[model samples]
Target chain A: MTSETPIIVLVRPQLGENIGKCARAMLNFGLTELRMVAPRDGWPNPSAGPAAAGADSVLDQAKIYDTTAEAVADCSHVYATTVRLREDTKRVVTPEEAATEVFNQAGRSAFLFGREASGLDVQDVAMANAILTVPINPEFGSLNLAQAVILCAYEWSKTQSLSQPTLTEQLPPAPQQDLDGLIGHLEAMLEPKGYFLPDSRADATRRTLRNVLTKPGWNHLEVRTLRGVLSTLAKRDRK
Target chain B: MTSETPIIVLVRPQLGENIGKCARAMLNFGLTELRMVAPRDGWPNPSAGPAAAGADSVLDQAKIYDTTAEAVADCSHVYATTVRLREDTKRVVTPEEAATEVFNQAGRSAFLFGREASGLDVQDVAMANAILTVPINPEFGSLNLAQAVILCAYEWSKTQSLSQPTLTEQLPPAPQQDLDGLIGHLEAMLEPKGYFLPDSRADATRRTLRNVLTKPGWNHLEVRTLRGVLSTLAKRDRK
Candidate 1:
């Protein structure tokens, strides 16, 4: 299924730094479209560049609108993000649920976020088809703008075919023969040191040692390096 | 299932602000215990407070250790967070998978985050039971300190019963009677306008209309509001 990314609309955001940070958060998850509804400090705020770190593309293509309605006018689905009490009745869904709906539906979706101090006005929320809220600490619901943006963006990204940051090709496990050789070398050294004492328990002790060594699923390179360490220790004992 | 919240250990972290932000990220998902290993600028850095915003309790109780081993000495399980190439053999798992394992195992777990620039070294990874990595963009794997902390914390929190930020007791769906009232009200207005034009397919058309209205699963207040809106539209037609 093609991923339907929603346009992020920041309604009257106060700081350029926060805008930049929000841009960084969006690009981190592959969301590009940004719409601003009457920014307090105005668009192209000089302070935003440095804060964005390197997400210049998001900041570069950010579109500004006069009002929330105009910003989301073209959207088939609009989710207003707010934590305050609403006077109008609207369906409330968590970020995860909203993201699922966004991906499932085929249309232009817009997520509307309110100003810094005071969130979206009643009219702004009424314009939205639904409300998206994050599961935050009720006692301290103090999520900043960028934090909120990242939470939503991250959830939506999970539904898409985004590449995992750390899933690179891994080396296969070492051959059993090589592992056994390394185990034998270690056992030979330990036998001289009397590390496995008590003839009655020697077999069980060796079995336990083998289990610990094999648990890591060491690759050939790791096995070689470990054997080298054991050889070095043995040579020191000879000295 | 009981959430075995992992102890976050910062190994040779450079900045106080980043440390504070990490604490904030941890608390955001209900992971509280934080241990710092040899902070460069020393503990209780003034810069951390403002950056942390209001996560004072986490910072106030932050523990400092001389080494990574000391920090995680008491923990039964240790996960090292890193994005670097390792020379050792260790099973690497994604944050989601690691979180699952963490919650399933019945013991104290510690997550170690390395310095901002270099990540965890070989020695640090060797100490860990497993490697925890986030799936990030290969081209730009520049996840800041707080971002990384929050990602793992959020994933782990999902396995727990921590109250969602927006899960205030919602009014159950509007009763079937109320929903029927809403459907009837809308149909009454549509009937006069001959919305069901073809007489033969009028029943099927009405069913389709009902299906659309019920899909949103509107609550009682939402249904009442829609009915009010319909009445207003009808009154305007009369005018």
Candidate 2:
């Protein structure tokens, strides 16, 4: 859950031209935060300058990261954009749904987009709490990166002033790092007890667990309580 | 008054690349009809092909006109797209209002866009029944030709059934009884640890915890997962 204007995170984006176009698209809809996870041509590319079409501020201020996880660590609500819905338990939300949620909820939200050739990897998708899918023309659904970014940005921009006046009284969900700590604690405990046995299914089991935990959108206080619960149970056993 | 799909008219557009981009943008939102009035480089421009990307169909079927008046000769409701509101009697409508009007009224509607450097001329403004403007960021309102075209196209697409499916997948919040059971389980576990020992404040602390837990409205699956987690921890302690 998040009330902050969502940031755009491009994961392993390929072209400098597309990156420039993305920056332009984002700025067009009043979005400024641009996080890139390992660009193919590297940052500060000459091709980007010409294509940005005067959105250099977004590009100039763009932050780069080595991995998707690190990029979204501060975000509380992370949305992964996918062309086609994968067979997963994660909830699928439209651009409008996501836009509305951002305004009414309480934490920082980030949208994730994969590279040019293929969309986000299975691992990257697992990292996101939900999937953001744009329903386009079934006959000819060909939305490029900039186009996709524009739609989400446009939807979000629409809600800035007009969002429901009533804000949720609930606390915002814990940041990604906090959730990671909780998940890590659970994994550590479950690991020695063979909860992740048959190493082949470990990755999938972990992803399923993540999807289940993420669905609750637990607040920091709740996360802390759960963490304390774990410690208490563990300490009792140790004694 | 127009109920038919709105047609896009590019008035004396200067660049073929921009024309191609407009075509791509239009096709993205399921808008197919594109009209160009006196393109600078002439018809069948080479640069347009690459920029159109996969929207060749829109370009192939595009109608060319000698003037803006001739372009909308067959249309009844004409809209002039301008960067600024003209000081005239014309009713200024947002892209969304224009889109809603397009679906509600009767007769053919056409949206007119001007050249790359300069927008629609006074004569072109006079031809329209209303002016369609996108309210963007005042600080940086530099929307390119294709970007402008896409925003209008995207708004128009919203009225159609194209976006109906993307909003149906999210599960509803779980029932109240499930929430109570999960809260009870957590409280029972925490009780042994003296979490609610102070008799006077115990009720208030429990209420706070309940409020935090209830805020998420976790679905049955999530509640069940929490129950399993509590059981797992408690069973471990006993072992």
Candidate 3:
């Protein structure tokens, strides 16, 4: 479990049993860390025991917090689950892709699920570095709290290696350049070419482009090819 | 839109916003009937108006119910989504399989998602002839409320014909033992055989057996034929 283990933070969960069941799901994928933020019911809830089935240990050791930020404060990375799409939201990942990144990151990670009623308010979603959404039907896309966690956990479990350290660690970072630096170079090339109009929107567009490319777990070869394409476009515009 | 159109049932949803969002998901798949079982904030909730974005019709025509049974009373079939698995729970169908079954039934159907954290209680699941579970990772399987409904709605939408349906008045129910009955019969048959012995605890064996059969979509005739073979063996044992 070591570095691969994830901390599950649930904000304002309305039901004690859901907290318990979330614990059960985490155990299924060999994850244990649990954090609760301002849960509707008091912690150490008796209702959680039966619902957790045999995963009571997770409930026993769960940490409590007053805010979403506090729940994930110790983690190096955080992913917020949301059903509705926000136009201004940056760094959105489909649940499958987020799992890969979560497994690859070197430090502790946390995934947050909000209350049953309103879900995570925009404020909660904004707190996270990334937004994680399941590719659900545009119509009727309401998912229960525990179900969302299971999908993420399922994806993470799939990427786990048996003999190898972890799927994420196997690749390591490219010696030549990191994802952010390469993205920055590409955006610089595009900026002069009017690839993204309006100075105010340039950063957002570049970030969106970078977010899309990063989803595939790009390598040196792919990044170089992308950079080359940007260079060619830049030269043609200048001519 | 035929039985192929999956119905969305919000069981005792406390918040009107969730009910509205759930209706929006249904509308995404061209489903319109929104059944609410004892909503906490009452129907035509003002909070739901904005959260639904542009799905006011779903709230406008929403149907309210006193209980889950009442919510699904008109439908020929029902499915409940639960967070944790119970021993006596009906056979679990993945969202995809449930979509296919809905198409086959050629009858009105309801898929129930319960209150945020508690999920569907055992009685709730039993009411539905079957339990529908989204294929989540075994570990950390918490699904946000709207997201769960979205997945089922998405799968249900996929099986639909994009073209406008020619007016067909009625269709026959496909002949098959529903998954719940077939699995029960299979478990009973296995019990007499050494497949599940005094040493192998019936509950564990039952869960394992259900898990195996639940993966692939089994039609009614195929399930009946398998049960026939089991019945024949049981006959010999009785002699």
Candidate 4:
């Protein structure tokens, strides 16, 4: 359930830049499998490298096929992405629902996306086991190829233990003793500025200030930075 | 809970195509409000129109600001979307967690995205009430501007009742009788084809066939189409 990544198939994609962007989106979520069926201008377009930003590995390994059927022939589950009216009676599911199914199902799965100007034709839709649609505004249902790929990729990524940029290894919170030192330093700087002016309410104001400062659970680096900022302000007054 | 949409503020976004693509992503998830803080190429960029596809309204109504502070001046809650190290100790939440908070908490919320190359500076992050980070591949956390925007917008839209392109006014499942007829038609076609050649296993095979056909919960149209396919196959042998 955690490691299975869906293969992205672009059906008759028009632009090289879009193909590169799709690769970028796929790599963002840890997906690397990409299949292209009949790219209009052919493969290895020079414009793709810069557009991909840095996801060139996905582009390098992308497989090309002559038709949609061949692209997804190995997949046990196939999902076609489109907003156009599907004449066939294929079961349609939102990207969220489709992602859940993809995670639960065994074997490789493929997500098919159509061309830029026009979507998958009737024959393409018929080949898919299901239709994956994003809930979009009716007035403006224009989703670019990368956007569509990303919506599905992001949803699928949620089911996996992908590392979040913020969740990566970070500095531990400063110990309570260090935090107290930081609070004391700030209070000392504010005391001479009349920040605790009224004696009657001074105790309560100090407590409130302490609560605000402690709420963030500042790591040592943050505490050090704030102390530096206070020292700079103090030095300005001396000048 | 459904109608609340977050304001997307791009602080110092470099490219017009990226801005246009951001609008396209926002509209795909029913988000309309977009604000820009000093885009490098300038507002009403000539290149944006083509990149946006048909999401012109989102681009048309997009507001511009000279600074991040003024862009989120009216927002009660502001979230800074960044992967950089912040000197300030702000509470960080993943996009999934942030989307839940945005739906539950009342008041207008804003998400600030930084430039493509450098990301949000310390000043921009300091203004935000909290930090929002997408769980991405750590080795390559290079999510472009539009990819970041879509990740947040898609997560937020999951909390709303935005009409899914597939979930809108679908036909109900066909009656059991209709499905039974479809199964019978296929069985009849298979009868003469030696599909059930071994008499001893014919009964078990029929039951297995029924189980596979009934799993999809096909609507009337699908049943009719399957039956049509069966009839065509039967006629093919006659011709």
> How high is the CA lDDT of each candidate model?
0.75, 0.84, 0.65, 0.77
- Tell me the tens digit of each residue's lDDT in model 4 across B1-239: 34468999999999898888898888877888999999998888988878887888899999999999899999988999986545668898888888888898888899999998889988999899999988777776778788788888888887876465464465667899998998787666566555554899889778766755565466776567556444433332211
Off by over 4 Å in 3: A1-176, A179-239, B1-3, B28-30, B40-46, B121-123, B134-144, B158-239
**Best candidate (score: lDDT):** 2
What is the lDDT, from 0 to 100, of the residue B126 in candidate 3?
78
Candidate 3 lDDT over A27-117, as tens digits, reads 7666778888998987878889887878887888998888875676456566778877665324567665776777666656778898988
TM-score of each model's chain B: 0.65, 0.89, 0.64, 0.76
> Predictions ranked by TM-score, top down?
2, 1, 4, 3
Query: Where in model 1 is the C-alpha error above 4 Å?
Result: A84-88, A187-206, A236-239, B83-88, B162-239
What tens-digit string does per-residue lDDT give for candidate 1 at B1-239? 34457889999989988998888888877777999999989987998888777888889989999987678766656788876545334557777788777776655678889999888866566566667876655555567778878878877877675442332254434544566687778777666555565789777556555534443345566677556545544432111
CAPRI-wise, candidate 4 is incorrect
> For each candidate, C-alpha RMSD in Å?
27.2, 3.7, 23.6, 27.9
Candidate 2 lDDT by residue in tens digits, B165-196: 66445566789999999889888777777767
Alpha-carbon shift of residue B233 in model 3 (angstroms): 82
Error of 3 at B108 (Å): 2.0
Which candidate, 1 or 3, would have the higher DockQ against the true structure? 1
Best by DockQ: 2
Error of 4 at A179 (Å): 66
Each prediction's TM-score versus the true structure: 0.76, 0.86, 0.44, 0.75
* DockQ of predicted candidate 3: 0.04
